[model samples]
Target chain A: MATSEDGDFLPLTPVAFDILLSLLGGEAHGYAIMRSVQERTGAEASLHAGTLYRALARLVETGWIEELERAGSDESDERRRYYRVTGVGRRVARAEALRLENQLGAARAHGLLGRA
Target chain B: MSHRRRAVTERLYRALLLTYPEQFRERHGDEMTRLFLEKGVDARRRNGRAGAFVHWLSGATDALRNGVGERWNESRQSRREAGTPTANARRTNERGGGGMDSVLKDLKYASRTLLQNRGFSVVAIVTIALGIGANTAIFSVVRAVLLQPLPYEDPQELVLLWGELRNRGITHFPTSPPDFVDFRDRADALEDLAGVSTFQASLTGDGDPVQVDVGSVTPNLFSMLGIEPVLGRNFVEEDGLPNPQGALPGQPGVLPGIVILSHALWQQRYAAAPDVIGRSIEIGGGPAEIVGVMPPGFELLMPPTAALTPNVDLWTAARLDYVNSPRNNVVLRPVGRLREGATVEQLQAQVDLIAADLMIDNPIKATAGYRLRVENFAADVTAHVRPVLLALFGAVVFVLLIACANVSNLLLVRASGRDREFAVRAALGGTRSRLIRQMLIESGLLAAVGALLGIALASGGITLLLGFQPADLPRHRNRSHRWTRPSVHGRIRYRRGCDFRNGSRDPDVQVRTRRRIEGSGRPLHEPVPKADQERGRRCGGRVVARPADRVRLDGAELRGTEQRAAWIRFRRSPYVQRRPSVRPLPAGHRSSGFQS
Candidate 1:
């Protein structure tokens, strides 16, 4: 409950935020999340396998994400572990987006951005 | 992708993942491999093989950076928690509570105690000072006389070749010119050989005429010794050859009159003139041109006889008429440098064979008891002084041991008085080893201070010794008087004392002390004391007299007849009685005997 008001996670790493944004839709395995991040960032902020997993492990530790258990015996790829954003993770992502929007509005007031 | 290519790509990624830490690899190996394989297929589908390669490169770099970073953070965290271990556990694990910190504390405590007991401190310090001072002085003398190598190239290969008359019990008689030439030419083991003869020359030109020691050496002497003159050229073959036209206007059929000045004489007579070379000076009443100036500290080859001056002031060519000289004239000392890989025994064997051949060639010329003797040049120079030096060294070492025992006894008495202090310290949690260490540190501090004082005293002692050293003692200007500093042996003795004090009843300490005692046996093992005894027996009950008694004054006022009577009367006096044991035969008489 205090996560959204204090803005404790207002400054998320580009890769971590991107991973969170990619998992916003639904549960996805690690490889799918990496592809989604590359696609969403237009390949400007690509997350490699090692960087993705390291950030994923940290996010899970901070309670911003959780590993989802397999429900059925689909067993197509047993090696892949799925991950999803927790309720706190969704709030932190919304707070970070608001913080960025406020910075952009200030930049516009000072005419630091081109008219668009 | 083909199955084989996919398998190869998976294998490479797995190998790269192994670089991570064991805990990391175990938890994440399967997941990492699956992600990498899925990305590889997607990358190949999008951009082909090059895309897969790029993905692999980025992933590998990221893996390396994070893997190392994680392990570094872990170690830092562990180190931060290291101090939380229990005190007893830490004590057993660590060698000491605080290595350098404890030593500093001990040193502080030691100084305080020593200052508190000023009277005991003075006695212990003075005793150690005397012991260390005497040891240092004697060791310096021994080092100078025997241990230091001669100032020459390959000094060990240099030897003195003396002709011996075994039946007459004279083992070091000088070699005759013919015998030297024979050995030089025939002995394959000798690299080079030269002869030297000492002479008295009166220097007359620059100032008042003064008698100075001169060495008449063969032309090749400097070359054989591997020494070069500091100024001008060494003697050449032409200098030694007899000139049909004499060097001066009146003298006829004389050798080329060339002389090389020693550095001391050069400074004294010439006032170190730059143009001293090529200048004519009077030597033995004859005009001789100065060819060169030898460096300082150059000593001439001469027996350790007190009659001769300590050092040669000048050098000249022997210029012997080798072909016409009598074979029985044995006045020149032969010195030879051994060839590479040649042993003294081999050279001696060769010289003996040559002597036998010479004896057979001329029966009357070669004496019946003639033989060859080879001796190390350095050993021969210090032969007479080694015994007296070793004896002094032994005496000083014994005195030092007695001093050590006295100081140890004093320390024991003092320590007994401090029994209560130690008990109190133990009650305050001082371990047994810690208490022992504190005691050792106190003794070590005392020894260090004593050693510093001892060095100061030893330097003064050395200066005093050198002042009284005999002029004929072989010495060099480059030799440092402070060659033996009292550090190593003093520290060893201090260590032994500390061990003894710490555990008097410990069997290990007893064994260590015994071992140290056995290891520190006499350093000089030669029969030097026996040689001293032999010399005592040889010179016993003889009136020893100085050779200065033979100095005679010649002047215009004293006519020839009166002067001769005065000289004869002076010689016959009881004070100048002929003592064969002390006084060597006069120079002229000895040379005459050699010629006979």
Candidate 2:
């Protein structure tokens, strides 16, 4: 039951938004989320492993993310902690996407960019 | 990556992970290390060793920034939620509730109350500022001129020896070269003695022919003072002997033409050349070799008064022909450093014995009333200004006392008004000492603020006083730094007694003022009559009247009747008058009795 007040958190820090976007597909361990961020950004926004965990700790404190119970499997690394974005995190990510779209519209109006 | 490198990388990442806050590390330390090793391995596989190094570098920096930032934000949030107490309150509670805690609480309460009533704080602070500022300024001057040790080794043993005529009431007369030589050789109590004289010399061949004041000192002057020249050598014993025949083109019968340039003169004329030591320069139309450059601010032997220049620009060796110089030609001023364990009285007794011997040997030259007077060099230099400085010191101290009394009275009134509050606290089991402590804390706060402002005022006040100070005032630029220590100690003592039982009736203040007033009056009453008699003797004595306008040294006009009077006084001595055929040569050409 994410409230509309979650929309007020539209301006996510770039790294935090990228982390949330990486977790959007599914629950992922810290390494998978870091690798996903690098792949999606063409390795331009590679989050260091320590930096990724610090952001995750802040995101958990803000209630925008949660650590999930790791499934016990023979190949799974016992040290890896898996995280998933909450419903509020997803809603705030959507609000941020909308805000970016409006900013793109304003830039297009001023002839600073073209529609892709 | 190789297994060895990978193992090292993993260990390094684990150490870096410890930089995070303890709680965060506990939750994610192992996970963070696993991810780092995975990234390092991936980077090494993709790019190579440089890629892994870059990854660690960027990762360490990022972790440091974000980890510290997160902890700071967390603590700030908790503080906001808990409504954190002020620093004073935290200090009190952290001390575990005792006398210190109560004092801290009282200080906090007093500061807040004073802030609410700003007018009283400002007035009291301003009053104390003026008082403390004036006192500090005068104290610095007095300390520098009177109390501070002279810039010499074992300064307490240093003294000025003057030939005094007790019957004529004439004290502090100059010494003759022969007498000085005799005393230096005969005196057992003195470690060493040196004579210094000041005169004008012309510096030519460089810039405009500028007349510079030169000091002619004995070879032992620098060694006696325990100072070395910044470059080259001090005046060696050989340097003081007359130059051999045909050593220089001009100035026949002159001492070896060697000069030690003052630091200022070296910079001005030679541009502080490293080769200045061996170079030759024309002084008074004679080429003199530069033997040394004195260190900067090395002014222990400056003339007490000079008209053309404030400081001596050069030093030369005083080569005295004791055999030819008359015993009564009293021209050199002798300064001596006593040997260890030798008191002034012992030196005085030795000096008296020597004076008696000289009188018996040269009965015509040495008057019956002649005696040797030994005075501390610092006292002799500062005797002229001691009265003025003492008076100003007294006046400022009185002002500080008045200001303190007024502030104490104001605090008393405020404390009386807070009687009901104190009574209420006492009803709650607050002891009498606690109430007094609170009052004292309030006074301490006020005094602290006042002292801070006073120090600020004093810095500016000293600069202003120095700016307008008389040209002849004995100036020491580092004096104000010395004032800070004693004034701070005084301020602490002031605060200790701020709320003592007799705060309103400080007997010490009354007694200090009485002593200072008596001290100030003594200098004015006692010294004035003696100084007046001395001045009358100089003016009305049988010395020849040489007009100041007629006296010229190296084309520089000697100004004032005082200079002329001094010159006449030196020349009219029994020995100089006895040699009537010998004319008094200009200072630069004189064979003996060189004045610096």
Candidate 3:
């Protein structure tokens, strides 16, 4: 069940949703996230420095993602900050995915998905 | 593949990164730059220059779009977190705190009051307009001609060496070949010396006959100026030797009759063909081969009495031998570059000793009152106009201050009439600071509008001034068209970093563009313009060499036109303006004037 607090953020914008989706894979730096997101939805609509960092800032604010300390898995790890999705982020992503699924269901019932 | 060109691309990107707000830039700037460099190098390696060009074309847009977006968002976010602005005035209507909040309210209220007093507002704005407009016009000329540093290497170290006849009261007379040789050989403190004589001649053969200014220069003149030919080789020392009669073109000890084309003549006649180097041309109706082409905007500036025109269309080496030339035939106007840690005063002392020796040795010099005077090249060039410019600058400054004071007096008078409103607001619990702030905001609004109007008028005035650029005005060849902004922003930026009284920054809320290209990623060996070399030092490394690369890259300041156009687009961007706006005025309240 989506708590009322979490429900306020239900209909996440495409960029916020994509950022949360990219973080589903363990942890990554800014460039890595940009690369992964660009791979998913081509470089034509790119996540540049300003946009990527702003989305990251907003995500950190919403507790959807967290900045992490290097756990020393790679001993030579430099100042490249790594970020990962949080528990609340996972819940919000699940809620958003379900909402999208419901919309797809309605589309299917209305023969809008080329399945009629 | 030119790695230097690649480095220029990176340095430019780093300068562009200034568009982001400081905090956000601090968090991710280095990482972003590293990523950009890595991608740029990769793109270049994989697909060559065009691929890299395409990549950066998108990359530039991405950076500008996102950077401006982030800036707008940051301002809104900070305002929200800090407290209510005027939009939320009703929320804090009774409370007398919130610095920025109150300031905005005062601005809004002050604007309303000014609108109410139409006649007074018009009078005050017009007064300020005359003051600011005239000041701006003069400042443009002053900044262009006087303040603009001479386009050369270490211009301050460069000085004009002149022959002064103290007995006759002529200070800037030309020097003879023998005198020049003496100065050149004996003046150890002087780094290098070069002499030039200019004369008008008919240049024929390319298309039509045209009169051209020819500079008969010594061989060392090109090296002394530190300017290389944009194409072909500079004149060798042997080139200055006389071309004897019936001399073979390539025979040993025979001089080649050659001349270097000024950039203007080359473009005008030859259509800027690169292959014109070895082509035969006629100068002063005598056959000469074109050897080289000077860089665009290169000219020799000398004192007026030197009688050398600033624009020398053709440069031919002087064939007159310096060692054996006639002593009394004074023709060459000599200019010298100073060695490090040498001053004109120090040079004067040393030259006095040499002159005394010359007087003792040569009876002619003693009889003729031949003495030497060293002057800073720029100062000597502006000798006739410097005092006049200074006087004019002083007058404009006084006029502006008086206008400000006049407006200040008018404001006081207007404030006196608003006493009942002030009393009522005070009785209703308005703080003293609020009343004062309201009055301050009113005057500020009037001054701001006046300045804007003044900028418009000044631009018109500047066009007129530049149109008639008085014949005697020094450095009229300064190429001012490229540097002219002709707007209010131009003056404000001209004043920046000029406040010597305060070597410190304001402790108020910081603005965007705080870190202006103290490049963490300075592109090594990148080619920048001569104008940008001083600014390039701020980015670190000796990157201003490689004159072969004419690709000029001026940093963020040059982007004013695009930046402003993009600023309007960003301001209107829906994502940037998503936050609630300042509440709109009620139907009649906007024009109703402030009611007690």
Give the root-mean-square deviation of each candidate in angstroms. 23.6, 22.0, 19.7
Summarize candidate 2's per-residue lDDT along B98-126 as a digit string, tens digits. 34435666788878777855876788778
lDDT by residue (A48-83, candidate 3, tens digit) is 655677788889988899999664256644757789
Residue pairs of candidate 2 with colliding backbone atoms: B197-B595, B197-B596, B198-B595, B198-B596, B199-B595, B199-B596
User: lDDT per residue, candidate 3, B404-501, as tens digits?
Assistant: 54554345334433433554454444545455456656766777788778777777777777787667676665533322433443354222212101
Taking all chains together, each candidate's TM-score versus the true structure is 0.56, 0.67, 0.57
Greater lDDT among 1 and 3 belongs to 1
**CAPRI accuracy category, model 1:** acceptable
**Candidate 1: segments with Cα more than 4 A from true spot:** A1-116, B1-102, B205-208, B243-255, B305-308, B361-368, B467-471, B476-479, B503-596
DockQ of 3: 0.30
Evaluate model 1 with DockQ and give the value. 0.37
First chain TM-score in every candidate?
A: 0.85, 0.85, 0.85
Error of 1 at B242 (Å): 2.8
Stretches off by above 4 angstroms in model 3 are A1-116, B1-106, B245-254, B360-362, B467-469, B477-596
Better of 1 and 3 by DockQ: 1
